[model samples]
Target: MLFQVGGQGTRPTFFEMAAAQQLPASLRAALTYSIGVLALRRPFLHKVLDYEDEFFALLMMILEGHSLRTTDASFSESLYGLRRRAVKIAVNKDNTQMDSGDRLRLSGLEKHQKVLSVAFLVVLPYFKSKLHSIYNKQREAALQATLWGNDDASFGDVDYFDGGETSVARRGLLDPEASNWTRIRKRIEAIIGVCYPWLHAGNEGMTFAYQLLYLLDATGFYSPGLHALGIHVCRATEQELMDTSSRIARIRSRERERLRGPPWLKALQRVLLSCIYTTLDYAQTGLIAAVFFFKMMEWWYQSAEERMSAPTVYPPPPPPPPPKVAKEGIPLPPDRTICPLCSQKRANPSVVVVSGFVFCYTCIFKYISQYKRCPVTLIPATVDQIRRLFHDM
Candidate 1:
């Protein structure tokens, strides 16, 4: 059966679970883009962006660690009215499928489960990103080596993206042309080339399968990470969600009753406490609204034709006519095959469409680019008007 909001201890519906899962990733992507934009203005932010995976991972570690410790939910899960619980299987001594033989208990996760989950959420992704980057570097180096075929290929010239050489072994291996390092690098790259795709595919395939199974109600865990840690997300009861707020209000009420401060100070403190509580209560809802608003704006911009339509472009003005008196350029060579500019036999001949005169490709291109006119006829022209000619020598 599908779970509804406010249902205590009930498993959330697939939509809710999916929303919770997607929310964090969407927020992260938006944050990353924002950081990239800011980095353009702040040069040092570029360096920070280089280790963005680790930087964001550290932030997630703190946020998720705090959420898990206090509410047994990650920030996104909590925002979606869900909380994680440990799953324990129960079986009778005979190990039979009797009425009381097979049962499952849902409770708070153990200390180790929380720690491991935090690591999986924060550390694993950073390492995965780093590995993928390394693989790309190795693949590029391999391609460069192939292209440099038998030309003193410098297999070690490729720079590792993460702060140069990571170990002592790579310290002086930059000149591997004279040693067997090139062969070793080739063998290692060959192994990575063979294994990376399979590993990447398996990871993606397993994640998809797990999500599918969860959506079909065939699995308790929505992700492989959760399954490995025996964690299940369930809807938080209304009372549980309201407990902290009520506790805070009660404490504040007692303090108000015993207040010895001036009336204005007491009132100020009360207002501040109320504001803090209100902000905390509504912050998640506000964030969800903002994200949805941004997404709607993005969709509208992509699909709306009325907004910022391409401007019509007029054709460029024609180049000015040549002067008639002294002839704008030097006289053309009498021989048709000789270039007026280079004074040599025309090679890779090209014609200036505006002037109807042919010249060597290099000579005409340089002349039109600099002078913007035909060398022989002195007619105004542009490099764009030059056309290459291909025919039998």
Candidate 2:
């Protein structure tokens, strides 16, 4: 976590905080003043995109991720409302079964927001690199054009392929690429995102959710996204989801299973986390101002009391340990069979992390290698997701 300053990670060295990925201001709703202040002020918060290696950070992500799941769910509901509006704009008041499929697909896409988020996160840096290369070339061309007194020719006039020869495409994730393949890839990603939702839906959405939640500032995170989803959910009628496969019911059931605590408890945790986030926001914005204001207040109090004593406000109680783990380490619907693969008692129990479902260790490891998807969800996955589960009888 870089080196801590008085237990704060605001300023760590380059090597120490090496893996921490800094995100853009645009993602956090940069327009809002509240968000702006928080962004400007948080000196110690490294805005970590991935800190899975650190145990405390991992624990924090798990706690934060679930609390965020509630926030995300609320936000998803809001987004649907907006989508319904757009749909109405095209075909006003068309209540066909195909429309129901549209609602279901939209709902599914909203649920898989984290998966899309990861796609964007992975794409953006490469996109930036490509843009930078394009910009540099354009600048160099502009310079040459000006030097030759051909000022009429602009950077936009710069040719991509010199000597009219086709440039060979580069490969790999980081390579600067703009081609038909990118469009094809996006379409495929969209299909998977809507149909299957997150890669880790069972565990507080996907791994991407953690990054998004962390990237999203607490104060500014809620309103816009939630407003959009709320509209979609509110606009869709019971008949909208009722016409076909009962998709809403399935989605709701999955959500209930995903939540680690009771709904109310989970909501409370999010509320508290939001409050803490707000406090952090405040700290970030008026840090120096707060110190000066406190100094003046302390002086005034000292003068009034005719003494040199400092104020004696008791420190708040230590926060309760995060209720991250379940009471039994077993999922709810408690009496169910421990292994889904064999549908039997716990024998070599393991977890398929892609779907967050337990199975026989060997069964899942072998199954994932062959199928490359979670058996329960039928979602694409890899063998790396199979991990042993340790639960005492």
Candidate 3:
């Protein structure tokens, strides 16, 4: 009798179990006969069957003392071949199987065939593709998040998607997993480690080519003293530095020649070379700016300290103060000719002799500091020269 459930026959094959447990050793011995007989007669149903249910039914019958006698050798072989093919198809179609939660009761032959079909076609392939996609997506998301920042709006909303939490719970896209600060720090450290040697080796050609624009200030370069100082500082290790740079270049050339080989070998060499070059370039530019700025700050500090410490010498005797004029005798200029400094009618007006422009003494003094000449006529006048002219007036 076939396996029974609640007094009704049920499919005996279990997809999760090994073939030995689902079908007896006696049936295994007759597999060749049964397989052959089944194929020749084409005894199975050909409809769009629920294959897993059908597999369970056939497996149940085989287990329930249904034997293929050896006398019928070809018939047994056909049956065995049909069983194997059915199992393969069943396992491969595992993804389409109703979830365990949705499975329904089956009876006798139907139950047996369903289980065999699922094991051979459904369950196996389903897990393979599912696991593959899961890991592949995780790896891809990690790479994207590493290059570009996080994508999630919030971890709070991760569980709302229809396909369930698995979609967003994956760590790669999350903020905690994709830290830009950490990556930047690692990159900075790698750059410093790669470029420090070239800088320390005092490779002047490379250093000057890379650092010249940054070393001197734009305005200071116009001054002959400052320009000479900058050039002298840069040429400190002239001959020896040049020789060292030449040797390093020769070494790099020889290394490149030695590395040239087969396509794959050369490709690997170029990738490594490119990474080092890029890293070094970033390091050199940043480090040069930092070093030059620090040196300027140091020079400023030393100059300030020396000036503060230097002795102050007495100058020649101070000049006598100018005599004050009587305010009543001074004529006030018209309101339209207001003083530039105080923005009031010019009291005690004085004609700027160079331009014949009249203004308060205070206004003319303030204007002369900025222009060193009359604002109207553009005639040159020093403060002393203007003071002498005013005294004579």
Candidate 4:
């Protein structure tokens, strides 16, 4: 949808496009199938592709070694203009000659400028932020659905609208459970590929191209930086998952070249990518992390309680007769513009129903994702519990 919004023909399927490029029909069909399958699993590809300028800059840096520097330094700081983006207009005010208010009113030019200014400055950003939030929630929901067998739950499953048998039956090593029919198809393709050199390159090239893009974070700036960093860590930790006796690992270790760079570089990556990046990426594992942390905390508390011979859930919350409650009600309600937690004007107001507290959405969510507690109340909270507070005009 985002890609469509960017412009039509933005997502030209590889089938017809490859054919036009003079690729063999078979290869074209294969690539189209593969990409179509990829789209179904990862629908956000459109948004990623929508921000083409950033990717183009990165590509030029990699391929051409230099790129033009523009005001749009990063994708997050998206530029606004009349071309494609919303246009900006400045409202002029002059009290000198006949004035411009009440009876005098704004001039036709001023009125149009004000409307355009509000649309570009306010409407553009607010809508984009909401869209981004929705995209992130979709991802978090998909992850939870996978881990907790909640595919049947409201979270929904990874869906593909269309795909060929080859793409669906096998996503190569990414899907180890290739059906028997898919295996037969692979064998047939391999035999034909041997006869036609272009077929071999064409088929392999499609997957390789997609993999390369995925590795380089093709949608780099649009996504959270930590996700790309975590992936690099996983790539470095490849050998961690291999069994000592695994045939492939043994073969590679025995005969292949392995470069051990500097000890310092290795240590740096361990701390930077493995530790920090991986922890931030764990925010996606919303439910899983919550369950895991409490389980560990419970075990520790039980051990401590056993030693002390105390009977309780574990260590209690804060020592309290609890904060004293006022018997009388306040004269006025809390400030709507200011966040209770931050004691500042809210930018993106969100509410914590359990604690009856309001805060900036990002501030509260990041804190909750990290500590799983409301900052003010120290009460348990989850990302799902944060409700966006909207005002109707």
Each candidate structure's TM-score, on Cα atoms with residue i matched to residue i, is 0.57, 0.20, 0.15, 0.16
lDDT of 1 by residue, 114-208 (tens): 89988887788777776687689777766877776434323364553443444324644655553477577767766777788788899999999
Whose lDDT is greatest here? 1
- The CA lDDT at 162 in model 1 is 42
Q: For residues 177-266, write the lDDT of model 2, one tens digit per residue.
A: 555676676565445444332322433353345335434432212223323333221233334434323543464457545556778997
Q: Can you tell me which runs of candidate 2 are displaced by over 4 Å?
A: 1-68, 73-113, 121-137, 144-393
The models' CA-based lDDT, in order, is 0.75, 0.42, 0.42, 0.42
Winning model by TM-score: 1
In candidate 1, where is summed lDDT lowest over 10 consecutive residues? 1-10
Candidate 4 per-residue lDDT, tens place, 1-393, comes to 001112132222333222222212222233334444567889876554455334333322321110001111111111111011112223344543343442311111233333343343234434444444445555565577678754332323243333243445446646565655667865654454344445435645864665455445472111122122111111101232233126433543443234246888656655554453344334224323443454565578789888889654767677445322233411222776776546678877888765666788988888889988766667778999999988653
How big is the positional error of residue 138 in model 2, measured in Å on the Cα after superposition? 3.9
Candidate 4 residue runs with Cα over 4 Å from true position: 1-336
The TM-score of candidate 3 is 0.15
lDDT for 276 in candidate 3 is 58
How well does candidate 1 score on lDDT at residue 358?
82
TM-score for candidate 1: 0.57
Question: What is the alpha-carbon lDDT of model 3 when measured against the actual structure?
Answer: 0.42
